[model samples]
Target: MNAAPADQIRLLDVQALDVRLSQLAHKRKSLPEHAEIDSLTKDLLQLRDLLVAAQTQESDTAREQTKAEQDVDQVRQRAVRDQQRLDSGAVSSPKDLENLQREIVSLAKRQGDLEDIVLDVMERRESLQERVGELTERVTSVQAKADIATARRDSATQELDDEAAAATKEREAVSAVIPADLLKLYEKLRVQQGGVGAARLFQRRCEGCQLELNITEVNAVRAAPRDTVMRCENCRRILVRTPESGL
Candidate 1:
C-alpha cells in the first residue's frame, strides 16, 4: 500500500496527543492533594487510637472511684456497728470495755484513711474525665479534617479520571488518522525511549528533550525525504518538521 503524505502529519498529531496524555497522567499521580490525603488518613488513625486509650483510662478511673466509694461505705457501716456496741454496754468486763474503746479508735482511724483515699480517687477520676473530654474533642477535630481530605482526594481522582477518559478519546481519534506502519513504529519507539517516541523539530531543536540538533544531524534530517520518518540524533525522538523548521 502506498503511504499517504498526510500519514506523517497525522502521526505527529498522534504523538502530540500521547505526550499530552502522559503529562496529564503524571500530574494526576503526583498531585500534592493525594499525599496530603494519605497523611491525613494516617493522622486520623492515630487520633482514633488516642481516643480509644483515653476512653479506656476514663473507664478504669470510673471503676476505681466506684470501688473507693464502696470501701468508704463499708468503713462507715463498721463504725455504726461499733457505736451500737458501745451504747449497749455489751462489754461488761473492764478489759473488754477497754478493748472495745481501742477498737472504736482503730475503726475511726481506718475510716479516716479510707475517706482520704476516696477523696484522692475522686480527684483522679475528675482529671481522667477531663482528659477523656479533651481527647474526644481532638478526635472530633481530626475526623473532620480527615473527611475534608478524603473529599478532596476523591475530587482530584475524579477529575483525573475524567481528563484521562477525554485524552483517551482524543488519542483514539488521532490514532485512526495515522497509518498502521507509522503507528507501529511510534509504539516501538515509545517503548524504547521511555514513553516518548516523537517530537517536533523546531529551529534545529528537538521538542521532546529540548536539545539542539548538531549541524550534521540537522542537515541529514533536512535532506531526508519528507515522507520518511526522521529521528533526532541527540534524543532519538521521531522528529516532525513543520513549515517553520527551516528544513
Candidate 2:
C-alpha cells in the first residue's frame, strides 16, 4: 500500500488504541468480581430454599400443636362430666356404678395421654421456631453478600466500558487520518495475522515476532522507499521502522 510515512505513523496509533480496547474487554470479562457475584447468587438461592423449608416446618408444627390442645380440652371435659354423674348417684345399680367408675378412669388416662402429646408438640414447635430464625439470618447474610458482589461487578464493568469507549474513539480518530486503501490493507492483514498486522521494527528486530532481521534484509529495508509498506520476513506483519532500528 502507498501510504505516506506520516500516515503509517498515525496508523500505529490506531493499532495501539485497538490493542488497548481489546485488553479492556478482556479485563471486563475476567474480573474477579464476576466470579464472586456468581458464587454469591448461588448461595442466595440455596439459602432462600432453606428459609422456605424452615418456615413450612414451623407452620406444620404450630398446626399440630393447635390440634393437640383441642383434643386435650375435649377429653378433659368428657372426664369431668363422667365424674359428676358418678358422684350424683345417677346410676343406682351397683354394676352400673362400677361401669361408670371404670369409664371415668379410662377418660382420665386418655386426657393425660393427650396432654403429653400436646406438650411434645409444643416442644417440637419451639425447636422449629429456632431453626426458622437461624435460616432467616443465613438468608439475610447471603443476600447482603450478593448485593455487595453485584455492586463490585457493576463498578468493574463500568470502568472497563468507559475505557473501551475512549479507546474506540481514539482509534477512530487515528484511523481517519490514514488513507482508506491503507486502512483496508491493514484490516485484511490483521485478520490473517491474528489481529496483529502492524508493529514497530527496533534494533533490527520485528517487534511483532521478536525476531532479528538478517544483515541483507536490514540493509534492504533501510534502502526501501519510505512511503512503501514493508513486511517482516518471519511473521509477515507490516514493519514500521524507527530510529532505533539498525535498518
Candidate 3:
C-alpha cells in the first residue's frame, strides 16, 4: 500500500496524539486523589460502625442507671416509713422499740449500698455517652475530607478527559487526509504492536525498534518510491522516512 508523503507525516501526528491519549487515561486512573478518596471512604465506614456500637453502649448503660435509680428511691422510701413508725411512740414495749430501731439501722445501710450502685451506673453511662460523641465527630470529619477528595479527583479527571478529547479531534482531522486503506492497515498494526504502528526512520534507525537497518534492508527502502508505505523488517512497524533517515 502507498500513501502520499504528506499523508505519511499526518500518520505520525495521529500516533503522537494516540500516545498522549493513552497517557491521559493512565493519569486518570493513577491519581493520588483517587487513592485518598478510597481510603477516606473505608475509614468513614469503620468509624460509622464504631459510632453505632458506642451509641448502643450508651443507651444500655443509661437504662441500667435508670433501673438502679429506681431501686434507690424505693429503698429510701422504705427507710422513711420505718423512721416515722419509730418516732410515733406506737410501740410502748422496750423490746419492740429496740427491735424497731435495729430495723431502721439495717434499712439505712441497705439504702446507702443501693445509692452507691446508682452512682456507679451513672458514671458508666456518662463515659459511654462521651465516647459516642467523639466517634460522631470523627465520622463527620472523615466525611468532609472524603467530599473534598472526591471533588478534587473529579476535577482532575475532567481536565484529563477534555485534553484527551481535543487530541482525539486533532487525530480525526489528520486521519481525514490519509487514504482509507493506509489507515486501516495502521489501525490493524496498532492493535498488534502496543499502539505504535508507525515510526520515523531517523538516524539510520527504525525508531519503533530503535535498531539500525541491515545494508540490504536500507538499500531496498532507499530505492522505494517516496509514496510507498514501507514496513521495517526489524519491528514490522510502518517506517516513515524523513530527511534524517540516513538513506
Candidate 4:
C-alpha cells in the first residue's frame, strides 16, 4: 500500500517503539526471578512433603520409645517386689526359699533385657527427631527464598510493564498521524515478519533482513515516486528509503 515518504519514516518510528515495547514484555516474562521463583516454589512443596513424612515417622518412633520405657518400668517393678520379698524373709521353707532366689535371678535378667530394648528405641527416636528438626529448618529457609524471589519477580514485572505502557502511549501518538490503511497493513505485516513491519534501507542494505538489494531492486526503488510505499524484496517488510539508502 502507498503512503507518503514522510509517513513511511513515521511508520518506522512507530515500529521501533513497538519493538522496544515487545522486548520489554519479553524481558518481563523471561526474568531470572521468575524462573527462580518457580523453581524454589516447587522445591518448597517437595520439602514440605518430606517434612510431613519425617514428622510422622518421628511421632511413630516416639510412641515406640514410650511403650518400650513402660515395658522396662513394669519389669523393674516386678523385680523390686521380688527383692523385697527375699529381704523380708517371707518364704519360710527351704524349697520355697530356693525357688524365690531363682525367681529373683530370672526377674533381674528380664529387667536387663527390657532396659536394652528401651535404649534401642530411644536412640532411634532421637535420630528421627533430629532429622525432623533439620527438615523443618530447611523448609523455613526455602520458603523465605521463595517469598523473596516472588517479590523480586513482581517488582521487575511492574517496572517492565510501566515502561511498555509509556512506550505504547508514545507509539499511539506516532501512529495517529499515519494513514489508517497503512497502519492496518503494517500491523498485519508486523505479525508476518516476526515483529518487524517497517525497516530503513540503510546504505543499500535492507536492515530488517540484513540483505543488500540487487541492482534491479535498487533501481526500481530509486525510480519509484516518493509518495509510493516500498517493500524489501528479500524479506517482504515495509522498506523506508532515506538519503543514506544508497539507492
Best by lDDT: 3
Per-model root-mean-square deviation over C-alphas: 2.4, 1.6, 2.0, 2.4
Q: lDDT by residue for model 2 over 46-159, one digit each (tens)? A: 888888988998899899999999999998898899889888978899999898889888988998999999999999989989988998898888888888888888988998
Question: Judged by lDDT relative to the true structure, which candidate is superior, 1 or 2?
Answer: 2
lDDT, model 2, position 139: 84
- Pairs with backbone N, CA or C atoms under 3 Å apart (clashes), candidate 3: none
Per-prediction TM-score, please? 0.88, 0.93, 0.90, 0.86
lDDT of 1 at 129: 83
lDDT (Cα atoms) of all candidates against the true structure? 0.81, 0.86, 0.90, 0.90
Query: For candidate 3, lDDT tens digit of each residue in 61-144?
Result: 888988888888887888788788888878889998888889888888988998899889888888988899899999999999
Residue 198 CA displacement from its true place in model 3, Å:
1.1
Give the winner by lDDT: 3 or 4. Answer: 3
- Can you write out model 4's per-residue Cα lDDT over 76-159, one digit (the tens) per residue? 888888889889988789998898889889988887898898888888888888989999999999989988888888888888
Q: Specify the poorest-scoring 10-residue window by lDDT in model 1.
A: 1-10
Candidate 2: 10-residue stretch with minimal lDDT:
238-247
